[model samples]
Target: MGTVNTVYWIFTIGLAILLLTAIIVLLFLWKNQGQLREENRKLRMSYDEIEKKYTGVHAEQLRYKLNPHLFRNALNAIQSHAYQSYYALDKLSGVLDYILYDTDGRLVTVKEEIEFARNFIEINRLKTSPLFDIRIKNKINEADPRCHQAVIAPLSFINPIENAFKHADLQSDNAFISVSFSFENDSWFVLQVANKTNDLPPSLNTRGGLGNDIYLDRLSSVYGVEGYSCKESINNGIFITELRIKIS
Candidate 1:
């Protein structure tokens, strides 16, 4: 009887030890799995951050790629009109040089931008007839030291001017486009573009056409939420765009 009792006790002790070891193993595996999951989550977050940065860089690269095509088209136009009007060709050449070289920079002086706008206007005038009335009122003198100090994003005013020309009715008797630039309180710079619209192309009438959306995106990237304001209105066959930037 004593021997049988000893054997039974040994068997029971061994079984208990086995069960304890199994439980410890299971706990260790659970802890290791949790750690692995946490590491995986961190890796995913890091990948997302890297993807976002790459996307932004890729988008900026695409935007700059457009510059070469624009330059080519402008040069072709200049070449076509070279012999017809020396004044127009000269203005177009200056504008092209600014766009190709000077405007490779992200920012430009207010004086430079104004000169670019004037050149663009003169080039457009050469394309239109006497029936079209284009008026430009620039209050900021380029010679003023203050004007030279003011700066803006390159090609900031050209988009609206292009849109105006794209939609204006040059054949109508009342066809007109007005462009004006002025300063308010010596702190805010304002650009206004208005045109009589009679026959707008279907493409430009769409929601995202004629590079308007791109212009707005560029503006938002350059100036945050409060730095600039843009207002557009369409009424009675007229289209108007106003841009206000706080330069100070």
Candidate 2:
């Protein structure tokens, strides 16, 4: 009977030790798991921060990828025309069509660009009086096949046009915006947009729009220094922006 009791006590003590060891192991594993979860949470927060910065920078780059003056001013001009005329909507569809579809390519034909410029100028005309000094001289031969074959980078020429109309001092009797396009020696093409300057009313105040320098930079980037040349001059309150490019 003494031996049996001793053996039973030994068995009970061994069982208790085993259970204690198991509890210790379980506690250690639970603590390790908690540490791993914390580390994972920290990594997630860091990734989110990186992703947010990347998104902001990407948004900024994409915004400037497009020349804001081209499409934004087109929309504004279209809306203005909506209030003024209904009969000319068909003729004015060029701006809408270009905005929606035609301006998808990296390069566009001289003819199509010229038509776009003409449409833009015509629509802007309704903004001012009939006596406004707005002039357009398109010397490139429209019927020539080269107009289609000789291509240039798209959106290169229209920024200056939008700039001119936006800052033009229409209050002055001598205020003028003139646009001219010509081909030199049939090898290089030229585009010039000029406008007068004067103090504008608070209602017409247009500040902080992209200017000639931006467009000039685009010209240089698209067509290296040898392929393109741009000049901007402010002569006696008249702003002139001229761009010349070798035909592609």
Best by TM-score: 1
Which lDDT tens digits does candidate 1 get at residues 110-208?
A: 788888888888777655665579999998776666577666667878777876766677788888999999888887889999888776533334623
TM-score of 2: 0.61
lDDT of 2 by residue, 1-248 (tens): 99999999999999999999999999999999999999989966855653443242322221124455555555565577676565345435876676556655335678877887787687777767679999898887777767876766665666768767777898789999999999888778899988898853222222324454565566665566798886767777888878787874
Model 2, which residues run further than 4 Å from truth?
Answer: 1-84, 199-214
Whole-model alpha-carbon lDDT for candidate 2: 0.70
lDDT of 1: 0.73
- Total clashing pairs for each candidate: 0, 0
After TM-score superposition, the amount by which residue 231's alpha carbon in candidate 2 deviates from its true location, in angstroms, is 1.1
| TM-score against truth, every candidate | 0.65, 0.61
